[model samples]
Target: MTITGRCYCGELTYCIESEPIMKGNCHCRECQYFSGGHPNAFLVMSDSTFQYTKGKPKTFTRSDLEKPRTREFCGNCGTHICTKSEFRPGAIVLKAGTLDDMSLFDKPDMAIFTIDKQPFHHLDADVPSYERMKP
Candidate 1:
């Protein structure tokens, strides 16, 4: 089944031709900074199944180091969209909140970067959390 999403302003949209590899929440310092001080929930899918169906987005690279990941966002409204990480080849990280019909997706199976999770954010005991990225 196809999955679709759009940026907050609806300027940037995308389509995923297949199911995601995984869904998770990231509380990494980088994610908190980019997501306005909170964890970012997203779907991890293959690049082969991803497509841009609407306006172009501006990209921001995280880390100048060897494995820099790129984030794509709506240029018009500055809405966060997706990410591409060299660390995880063949995968495209898509922001969950941007989904056109969020009900179709399941709850995140993992919570990454728990070491940096804010004190106020209480994670469920059963949500499988990791101090760093999911293994």
Candidate 2:
């Protein structure tokens, strides 16, 4: 399935050519601060299948975890667009909220980094939840 999305200001546009291998909500502190919310959903696509169409995004190297990861965002509105990992080899995680037709993707299968989850928001018990990043 082809999925398309754009940044809040419409300056950055993207297209993904395949179904995401995984989708989930991330509740890590970095994600919370980046999204300004409790959790942010992501659709994981192959890096080779994801393409930026409109403009180049401003990138920030946000972490030095097991893998070095960079976040790409619209410079104009500072909309978090996607996260890429140099160590992951072939994957790109796109911020689901940026999708123009998000309904096209299945509901997220799980939640990750729940150890940092906000205290007030409860998640559904049916989905598998992880204390830290999912493997």
Candidate 3:
């Protein structure tokens, strides 16, 4: 199933060739800070199968304890688009809200990094929640 997405400004567009491997909301402090919200729901796609349909997105390599991760966003609007890691080769996590048809993806399987989750946000106890990245 091919999926289409665009940046907030619609200046940058992308297409993914396959169904996402996973979909989930991340509550890590980094993600919360970057998104300016509770958590970010993202679709995991293969880097090789993801293509830019319009304008090149500006990329920034995040510096942290983990391996370097590259963040791609619209240069004009600064809409956070995708995050890719060489360490996790072939996988790119695309921000789900950016997709033109977000309903096409399955509901998130779980929430991660709940240790830093916002106090006001309440998640279902039934869903698997991880204190940090699952092993």
Backbone N/Cα/C clashes per model: 0, 0, 0
* Full-model lDDT for every candidate: 0.86, 0.86, 0.85
lDDT per residue, candidate 2, 1-135, as tens digits? Answer: 788999999999999888788899889888888878778889888888788899999998845566668899999999999998875669988899999997965677899999989886578889899998777
Q: Which residue window of length 10 is worst by lDDT in model 1?
A: 61-70
Which model is ahead, 2 or 3, in terms of TM-score? Answer: 3
The candidate with the higher TM-score, 1 or 2, is 1
Worst 10 residues of 2 by lDDT: 60-69
lDDT of 3 by residue, 1-135 (tens): 888989888999999788788888899888987788779888888888889999998999866647888899999999999998875688999998898987865578788999988987677777788998766
Evaluated at residue 49, the lDDT of candidate 2 is 73
State candidate 2's TM-score: 0.91
TM-score of 3: 0.92
- Write candidate 1's Cα lDDT for 15-96 as tens digits: 8887888898898998888789989888888889688899888999855578788889999988888888878898888888
Task: List runs of model 3 lying over 4 Å from the truth.
Answer: 63-66
Best by TM-score: 1
CA lDDT for candidate 2: 0.86
Would you estimate the TM-scores of all the predictions? 0.93, 0.91, 0.92
